[model samples]
Target: MIFTTKWYETVEPAGCKQRQSIVKALGLALGLLFSGHALSQNLVTNPGFENGASGWNTSGTTSAQIIESSGRSGNRLTHWSADSSYTVSTYQTITGLTPGTYRLSAYTIGGNTDDATLFASNCGNQNSQTAIPAAAWGNWTQVVLDNIQVTGSSCTIGIYTQNSDWTSIDDVNFELQSPPPGSGNDTAVEILAGKGFNYARIRLLVTPPDSYALHQDLDYVIAMAKEAKANNMNILLDIFYSNWWADPGQNWAPAEWFNQDVNTLENTVYNYTRDVLNQMAAEGVLPNMVQIGNEVNPGMLWNLGNISDNGWGNFVRFTNSGYDAVKSVSNNIPVIIHYAGVGSSATSWYASYTNNGGKMDAIGLSFYEMWHGTINDATTTISSLHSYFNVPVYMVETAAYWTSSDAGSTTSYPQTKQGQYDYLFDLTNAVKNINGFAGLFYWGATWTQSNNWLNAPDWQDDDAATRSLFDSNAQVNPAASAIVDAGGLSIRGVDISEAHYIESNGVEYLDN
Candidate 1:
């Protein structure tokens, strides 16, 4: 009867609704995964941009720069005009090339308005367009310059400010390619495996087993856990004190405990949490991460500590006690505090809560397109929030499609594939201050049809919905692909940054 017991791991008849549902969903996902495309390691490396070569600028260049005799420890030490800038002093050499069709480009960073140019021919054959300005800090940004002909052996290449002023230049590179390529999955866990995703965030509904009123969410958890282990995943069990949903508003105590005093009930929460965690401590198993309560903004475990006057005290007691119990059982696991808020203003939110002494290991935010607004909106919010909290923020729970493609009268962006791509990028970009960022977790890898628990007619899931990286039909959506495929979700986990991530070459991967 215990959750980790695997008691229900039987290979039951394929005809059962539950089993059938899983198989169908898994198959659809597989079909879509295999059908997904892949990205090529399209990189550009410049042969120059080092040691201020002799014939570099005078050969044909723009100058508004000087060089620094000393460089940074982990970075290239170089300078342009003015005190120092990435733009301004890009040595310019213009070349002429015969008429032809081709894609040309360079990856740069730093100069927000710097525009490096790749020339066509020496007659200044009129083929110099603005290369997107880039300023290198401690990272990389690849910029593409498309369609140009190499009529002569070489023409001219120049790096300069957007307006031909002073700027800085750090690491520079060049590359020629048709386009970038991307990959797909062929089975359950296959694609996710490919994406270097090595963990899963699962939710558990802690209920007395004898209570038939409990959510079968436990059933879903076990099913997911087995699959997760099979995929070599580390789990983050989000245990909600409620039999169903638990949040600041309704941290419903178990039905049996309704009559119990707040003190006794609070102890019950601690004891029950410890009991559950202890039971799950087999095979080096215990949640790698656990969230004590869902969203405790207004506070949780109501009644005696109903957030009246000494609400903070009560909340602290409940949480600290819960924390003590968890630590007593397993001292190493990290606990997260989650919340639902608009990304538009993370400062005003966390400044008010976290700054006020709310105990939490990490700050978690749920940025849903339906609620928090655009991808850009969410991103800007995170950027500001990070500065204020000086703590990490996880794009904890987010989903795009309200319904499978109905694109409700909602204001969600794109409402299609392009929209999905932009939304994901927006999130990643929003958390540019990456080191402290954790990861983004999609709320539902769920699909609904007819009138089941998951089915919500009002919830339109445009194939564009960036929920599970795959749709209800099991097709690979852009979100999942973009995650590991982009650059390994640095904000998530390090495991996602390796080659042969989830799986490779017709075999599964080990939990590295």
Candidate 2:
């Protein structure tokens, strides 16, 4: 539910200056059947412009020309005007496509003062354009235009720079991208399961504001639980306890429950949790583990459960209500208290919760290198938490970027496939070495460059596209191997059925 933005400066045809943030829309145009088969051939002729634009058409006030010794591979196409501002375009029309979705990609580097886009137009659906960041100069950055549905037989693919100082493009490629594989059709998830991914962590929202992207309703959760069970994977249901996103910065109560007093709100929380679990149980898809609330380090349900304003007493009361509900339905389901990030703040958050008599069977933490400290720091924090709390520790969420295009900040990893693999491998080893470490889950393992949801004009672009286990092509990347090898054979020694239990009518626990 984290969002990031990349802005682009565009010049309108009416001589108007406009600045817009890239907001990617979720889902594709309906009724367009995309085959799962991908075409490996690069459809663009003279893709690198090494042959001096043999198959390209250059147009505009300042014509784009091919230059040697500047291409990402051999020769790059560049456009610039020192005398005055001008527009230029280097393009090619691809015909006789297979009538499916296509992906256009290219490496670009140029000055920040100009507006440039790698675009695809005249296809079946609406035109798609990916802005080239102004700061991408001096370094080759790959930009992609995905989900180009080709209902016809042709599409225009090119790079256009308008009213600019200088821009350069190289190694342009246009190829067909396979559609998302259906359940049991996703080779990547199957591979992860084969490699040792026993649990699938799914987040549920009460009623997501954006149903297309943030949709995690009860039906959705039940369906996912059924899929995980079918795949022989355990389920970790993460309840956000809010209508929309619930993170450290914002955990607003659902609109209906926002006005309730403390006692009323506590009862509401218990009833809601019990209802959700009861439904899941009826469908024979009850989760193996349930988190009371996601990343509640800042507390949930706003003023009623916001520890900062109302203190831990109210927060603990709400949390215990949720814990009680989970136990009411099934004693086998272990309750996890999830906290975001790791450091002194995390330690203090847990300490305060435990001191307030909060109930939890496991400690779950979210670790991202850019937000949290180093991997070693995470390991140290994990060991400390386990030692003090006497509960199993789980790396409930973690990921590394396989590309630098959307990576906001720099890290020790190289932002390559291998770098992603290495980061995960080392972190898994570090945590596994700890005696109380339970397991790990790679967040967004199946997220791809296509179907970007966080792209509404009000929201920022989805920057986590490159952090997925799959590449833009929807193929499993090398980083997935690290996850498969790290915990493929190890099993934690906690039994959901016998380790803990609670009376059906009360919150008191009977420890095994």
Each model's TM-score, in the order given? 0.52, 0.60
What is candidate 1's lDDT per residue for 1-512, written digit by digit as tens?
Answer: 00110111111111111221111111222111111123233222322344554435532123444444223222331333442422333343432222123333344335445333332222111233333444456443444333332222233444434343423443333333331101222543445545565676666665523122223233234434444555577776777666656655677655767678768777987897787677566423466777777766666666544555454656666776677778888778776777776654456645555554655666777767675677666666766766666776777776554233454446556566566656665666556456566677755433222122222244344332233355544455555555554554643421121111111112222221
Error of 1 at 143 (Å): 70
What local lDDT does model 1 show for residue 95? 25
* Model 2 deviation from the true structure expressed as Cα RMSD, one decimal place: 19.1
**Each prediction's Cα lDDT score?**
0.48, 0.69
Backbone clash total, candidate 2: 1
* RMSD score of candidate 1 (Å): 26.2
- By summed lDDT, which 10 consecutive residues of candidate 2 come out lowest? 496-505
> Candidate 2's residue-wise lDDT over 1-512, tens digit each?
11122222232322222454443453433111222224377999999888987887766753434465667888887767665666767777886454456777777765653577776765632455656655455677666666665543467788777776777778888887763211424344344565456787878778765332465666555645555566577888888899977889989898978999999999999999999998888777788899999889889999789989999999999999999999999998889999999987788889999999999999999998988989988988998999988898888888888988473667888888899989988887788879788888778666564343232464355556688766776566777668556663253211111000011111121111
Residue 224, candidate 1: C-alpha displacement in angstroms: 2.4
Q: Residue 378 in model 1: shift from native, Å?
A: 3.3
Off by over 4 Å in 1: 1-191, 208-223, 247-249, 304-310, 343-357, 402-409, 448-468, 491-512
Residue 375 lDDT in candidate 2: 93
